[model samples]
Target: MPKSPRKRALSSPHDALFQWTFSQREHAVGLLKAALPSSLAAAVRWSTLRVEKGSFVDRALRSRHSDLVLSARIGEGRVYFYVIVEQQRDVEALMVFRMGLYMMRLWEQIVRDQPGLKKLPPIMPVLIHHSDTGWTAARAFQDVVAVDGPERAALLPHVPCFELRLIDVSGGRAGDLVEQALTALGKVVLWCLSVSGDDARLEREIARTAAALDEVLQAPNGLAALEALLRYLVATHARFSVRKIGRLLEKAAGPRAQEAIVTTLDEIERRGERRGRAQGERRGRAQGRAQTLLELLTARFGAVPAEVSARILAANEAALVAWTTRVLTAPTPEDVLVEDGKRPAPARRPAARKRARRS
Candidate 1:
């Protein structure tokens, strides 16, 4: 038996979106099948794919430990696929070396758990690179070894080096998703992620990818996924407004998505001022402040549950103001907004005493 996975609180907006979309078994399976080399994809047992819990990412690099780990029957035994979504805006040459570190840690964990085991199962590291800039980093650990090929070749036998499978979903490769063996929702989510950096392209891609996104809405959790994807898109592309995003969704999924779009728009757009939703309206207003607080909470803590979203929406003006102030310093949503299944009442200003009958 393996250690159970924890309820990881993803820290970045990108991580939250990826975790929510890919963690679903259907999507995960699709991603793994497509990303794996054809030989392995053909041989692995898809029915036995199981998501494992707990992360092995180095704590020095991340505020929150996260990544998707899954195992499946390959041959007579098992194999692990450690999947991590890297959303760097620039090329990270050290990414594979870092991935190497993560893989070693995972192997160590498996060894610790099964002390009597003679041999270790193979762990394949798959990196999903989502960037505005396409991936330009070296794919193998040896590529970054800082030695000439001749010299590196001499030392290579001793170096415990490995390579990672890459799936580039940067702005330039959005169309590649169509060829990949992904579900409709997976394609839509990756498509949205791919074009997030190009606002103009996103508008066009939304229509181009409309069919898949429409299929996404038909799924049970499609609405929630759509909301998360839109929030991320609008949040990252400040130039895109809620109305614009809603219109895009309406255009893509038809007018029926309007209600869901509006509800999410209102919730997501409050801080529209910050994320380029409501332009030139950066005043100290209630809705703008509320939206900002909501975004901050989601970025740090993961998706806010519906009840928590309602609580944020229902908060008094003072509470909204207080929560916004607290969110900057607070560690969790509970630290900033929630307390005892509710938010603590906003601190009140003391009444001033009047001079008695001075006249």
Candidate 2:
């Protein structure tokens, strides 16, 4: 019997992988067209699509959903479409509410940035859900609310209403996505996301996936797409190691595909090592600076107090340097330890009491 696939971790890598893949203009446009309603998709002028900076979600909520804001011409109007790429394992009950919040934030940012513009660009929100289970949550804010019928009708004009153009990839057909996608890159990415984390499904689709990747490899900017796809594959699969995936690629698409996969892996390893070394060097420098500051304080003040020594050790490189510079002119230990632009409190000495007889 085939071994069961290991459960993958729910993390930012999935969100990051999707963001990277869809950051490409062509891929983003293809995704919007494939996932959006036929009427909205038809209105988008693909050639005018541009990926914008800043996510709709605040920093804290970004891990749960990766956002992509793309501006495009829709029926002669320039509109922003916020794509919330959700990779959570379970469905969020308040997804519609969250979408409304994201849309409002996007609008706020637009107003803040372009103060002179009298009219704000309309936003079309899209939610692309990729989880093990299909999304069953309400797609409109009104649907999730308590009020309904007559009461809902009375409050409809007062309350915010927005609907998400949802694309549920869980249990979706790869053939459907492939047929819908405009570019080979889009097709392969959509197919990969649809079957990710299922070793059995991945194994079954290996040949088709390899063929799609090979087609992407031949196109312009193919190398980047290949690297992104390889990274996504490694990220999503728990059963297959990078080496195992590379071997699978070799078997499916020959040595060239395998070589590309291996090269990308090697490059990632090299970058990681370099980053590690750089961080280590930074920490070493900070420690050395802290030690030097401690020594300078000891030399100037003679035997630093426990509290001061602890502060010195805890201080970062910048703080250590600042204190070390102050040691040259500061009269007291307190003065030397004091932060820049702040005066140390003056020491108070009790005056000598006059003799009772003399008074």
Candidate 3:
């Protein structure tokens, strides 16, 4: 029998998002360099990360391993960057707490190793969210505590990292970058940037990416790799179009080569299209469920605050759809903020008892 997929340690609704991010390391690194135009970004030439976990217990505790860690060239020296990319499709409020533990571990590891070296490279915490629910406030909890009032004050010495919400990148923006070659790293960064648009623009961008992919595939000795990438893109693109795929195939490879490439692309597209449609249906159900939960909240609490409602409404389609079930099923608003069952909140409390004892 075929073996089951490996179970991730931290399974949240954004599990797919996390998995997607880790798998695209090249794309992740490209994004890091592009987003931050600092010394680390500029000084770096190439990047990669050590992803293995040793068997020793101490290694597990002391090591500052991230889902995706990148090492970049900084002129004469190399700087290592850690990214804790969380997918907050349905769990927005919880990151307020998670950022603390993640940042602490990284900082602690950096501090412990400082005596050996004159200075340590900068470490960054990046939260990339596809869902709208988590972007309720400008700052995640990690961003708040690091600040020592509005005036200048050195509280933590190191700056707390910022969060990037993919849901904010719109279709128009996706169109702007679609024509660009974006290295594998660029693709990963673009994924986050693509989070803001509607299905049509998303489809257009996917087509553009597919076209670019065709170029890569047509590259000498790149057929196999390009085919694999196309398969992945088809699976991920929610509104994949067969005609677009066919046209791209024809354009990338003339009539003679089209047969072979088209055949493979077609098979993958058919399978992926089916899967994508099912995913869309599931998202629809989730949205409906979330709406019902919101109704319940309104009945019980006299409507969720306008700010909260606006944020929730502003959530991107992918995230809003994914979290529908979570919002409806979750026990409390706080629960809605958490990914999966893990929470930063203390133990749940019993509701107040109505008093009518002997008086």
Candidate 4:
């Protein structure tokens, strides 16, 4: 089944973006480092060993894991790395809360899992936002701090954050990178991925963009990434979000890029169509079942009101599903009510009886 949207809040845009861009856990790590500064990138070893935990809020507690993790040996001390990629086009203030929770959990896990280790390394939370919201200045936990007194203020140091703004690097810069990557038709690919709707106009823009990319970067991978991007757009049926665009870029890069994008896009579309059909069928069946029950109620209760029928139809799915299931075993409308776990109060029976007697 195509996965339903994730209900729990995500840690950061970094984590979300990582999953979208690179399907594989390890690839996300490599790609992340590539985007970071050279000094930090060189010291780190991207580890594929990921830890999974149950859903923080649910009963089944399904596992949610990190996007990429690594350990860096810096000045005789080993620092642990945890990165979450996000590609949201809008601000999500709630992410701070989610990240705070994840950070606490990670700290607990580190202590429990590695008892021999003396100390934990400074953990850096990185956010790579690709939104038209345009990049806001990078912020860290330290930035929000307030020292009420002079003594308290003296002890605190600014906690630097690892945040990168890719939006600052625009179309012209992107084309230059494509040229260096030696990809054929690089800019064309980028424009196609970025352009919204209007296929004919987009095609013209793509051709022009491709020519620009050719002017800058003459690399093969650039071309590959571009091609893969086009195929992905043609394949997947999603609105163009920054995260989706990043995913398309990742899907487009490499030797098998074109083929992979085609396959994945086709699969996503097929699964989406199937899911829609299944949901429709479920809804139709539920409606059918409810209609049958309404007819029975009208027959047994002597003309059930239209308002009551609408209420039943508009009821929640969980309630509707249960009610529909009960209808199969219920003998009458009264039986359906009890089967649905609704029972009349004994206190009301005398009044109902008096009213019926009077009528």
The best candidate in terms of TM-score: 2
lDDT (tens digit, per residue) of candidate 4 on 50-94: 334422322221122233444455556655445443333445444
For residues 1-359, write the lDDT of model 2, one tens digit per residue. Answer: 11111121224555656677677787787787776667767877889999888876878877668788989887757889898877667899998998888888988999899898788789888887877768878988888888866787888888777888877777654322325555677777666777767888777777876677787777766666666666667777877887777676667666677666677667755765887899899889989998888788888789987777777788778887788888889887777778656864555669999878954
Total residue pair clashes for candidate 4 = 28
Task: Give me the overall lDDT of model 3.
Answer: 0.47
In order of listing, the candidates' clash counts read 2, 0, 5, 28
TM-score of each candidate? 0.68, 0.78, 0.45, 0.53
lDDT of 1 by residue, 1-359 (tens): 11111122113556666777777778889888778777888999899988887677766645322488899999999999998876657777788888888888888889898899999999998887776568888988877877775677789888776888888877757322334688887777777767755788877777877778778777777667677777667656788776887888888887766677777677655544454643344333666667777898888888976666777776666778777777767766766876545755655668988879956
Off by over 4 Å in 1: 1-11, 63-66, 149-151, 174-180, 263-359
Answer with 2 or 4, whichever has the higher TM-score.
2
Q: Residue 262: error of model 3 in Å?
A: 2.3
Residues 90-134 of candidate 3: C-alpha lDDT, one tens digit per residue: 444555345556555655666676667666665554544444433
Off by over 4 Å in 2: 1-12, 112-120, 171-179, 191-208, 232-242, 248-252, 331-359
**Candidates' C-alpha lDDT:** 0.73, 0.74, 0.47, 0.44
lDDT of 4: 0.44
Which ten-residue region of model 2 has the weakest summed lDDT?
Answer: 1-10
Q: Over 4 Å off in model 4, which ranges?
A: 1-17, 20-26, 47-79, 86-102, 109-118, 146-276, 305-308, 315-321, 324-359
Candidate 2, residue 242: Cα displacement in angstroms equals 4.2
lDDT of the structure predicted as candidate 2: 0.74
Candidate 4: deviation at residue 235, Å?
10
CA RMSD per model (angstroms): 13.7, 8.1, 14.9, 9.1
